[model samples]
Target: MHGVVLAVLLQATMAGGKHDYNAAFKSADESGKPLLILVGTNWCPGCVTMKRSVMPSLLRKGKLSEVAYAEVDADSQSGLAGKLMQGGSIPQLILYRKTSTGWRRKLLIGAQSEMTVTTLVDRAVEQQAALQAESAEQSVVTASHVEAAE
Candidate 1:
């Protein structure tokens, strides 16, 4: 019984909760990962489905662990929602990559099946890895050029 209770508690704690847009962006920037922002209202059925069904499956598969996940309530946090949306619809899933200028939106739109969401997340991770590698190469080249100049 004690073991069972401990397992349940651990699961509950590991499961993520709702987050704001800025917090999500900041986390992604700090971690060098992408941001997944779910924008919707409490009253939206699709939003509830996304939170309960799709997100959990992705989490179980460790798809979202590499990125920051956030939820913005459309009705309650209208201002933040609007800014994140930029005049988009509710139940929107926006994926942003951290860049020098800021977090640049990569993908924007609805919740998908577990497979689809996983695939999208995987693709984003691959893209981020490539970008980081490219940046590292450029930095090395720049350093070599500076050494030659000196």
Candidate 2:
């Protein structure tokens, strides 16, 4: 009975809170993927709306697999939220790209609908592809230059 109660409490606590951004970012780095940060407060209706309506639709339509999704609570992680977003508004969606500058923003601060979210995700994928192509081209150019020098 005691163990059962403890398990329930643990689940409740986790469900009631926001995601761990550091951990999520680490996972995305490991997977060589982008990261999506959804900043929201538990009591914020807009946040809840985005989570339930926009997020699920994107997920269902296979629009969210290329990146990792994480949620930060504005109320709980106010300092982190403030650093990321100027206004500290709920339902702030941020896309991050891993680079020499660390997690740089690809997009910031928008009112998200399902279509808008899908379009944003598609844009992120396109950006990633462009970066990869540029890197490959650079490598090819470097190899050719090295061969000419030899």
Candidate 3:
């Protein structure tokens, strides 16, 4: 049963895959992966540039081949923007990573090269792995305490 679940999850994190903001967050939680979010509005040229050129180029060059990505419209998702940011900026790449305490964010404002995005995503994934390991260790400790009490 665990093997089947692992296999399915392994298939899900093929990298460079684009999902919606909600899906990206869910995927990160489920697969223990990090999210690469491109925050923008429909009218923002920089956002369009990253979407139509930079990101697509990165995808074509296999730069983002190991991370999950999402393009979010900050203007439309005002509630999300208010919660996540002080300034709603376009073409901002935000990496949302899960930690033992909560979510950690790495923000890159404005347009970035393929390498910049790649490096950030890689770092976020590494951090998330550490967080997950810590959480697993805590769970083990908690379970042992419960067993000892019983």
Candidate 4:
């Protein structure tokens, strides 16, 4: 089961252009992978650097294989972008992970380096795995207790 989940996450594709928040969210939910959003406008330099340099480099290195990614243009998708932004700069990389209790959000404001982004992704994956493992263990314990009662 763990292998299957990891495989699904690693196999998740990252979309470069023409992004839709709804679609990306749906895909992440269905695939059990975290949703990663890059919010920026074409005019923003930091945004450009993220879209052109950072993201592509990460994708090439297979660092972003475990998450569903989307690029949101703040100019065009202002409504969605405004909602997602936590009062920060142009280039904001937001990650939404579904945990055992609910959704967990992590945000990085401004242009970030490859190492920084990689660390963020790695931490998210690790946290998610830990939460899932704990959940599974609880389920097993609950099942055993119920069986003994029966």
Best by TM-score: 4
| Residues 1-150 of candidate 4: C-alpha lDDT, one tens digit per residue | 999988775553333233557777888888767889999988899999999999989988999888888888888778889999989588999999998677899999999999999999899888777777898899999999999999
Pairs of colliding residues, candidate 1: none
Please report the TM-score between candidate 2 and the true structure.
Answer: 0.79
Across 49-120, the per-residue lDDT of candidate 3 in tens digits comes to 888888888878876655667776676666766666546566788887766677778888887877887788
- Per-prediction tally of clashes: 0, 0, 0, 0
The lDDT of each candidate is 0.77, 0.76, 0.75, 0.85
- In order of appearance, the predictions have TM-scores of 0.78, 0.79, 0.69, 0.83
The ten-residue window of minimal lDDT in model 3 covers 11-20
Better of 1 and 2 by TM-score: 2
Specify the highest-lDDT model's number: 4
Residue-level lDDT for 66 in candidate 3: 57
List runs of model 4 lying over 4 Å from the truth: 1-19
lDDT of 2 by residue, 70-135 (tens): 777777778988877757556799888765456667555645788777777778777777777887
Model 2 misplacement above 4 A: 1-9, 16-19, 99-103, 106-111
Off by over 4 Å in 3: 1-18, 133-150
Worst 10 residues of 1 by lDDT: 12-21
How high a TM-score does candidate 3 get? 0.69
Q: After best superposition, candidate 4 residue 101: deviation in angstroms?
A: 3.1
| Model 3 lDDT, full chain set | 0.75
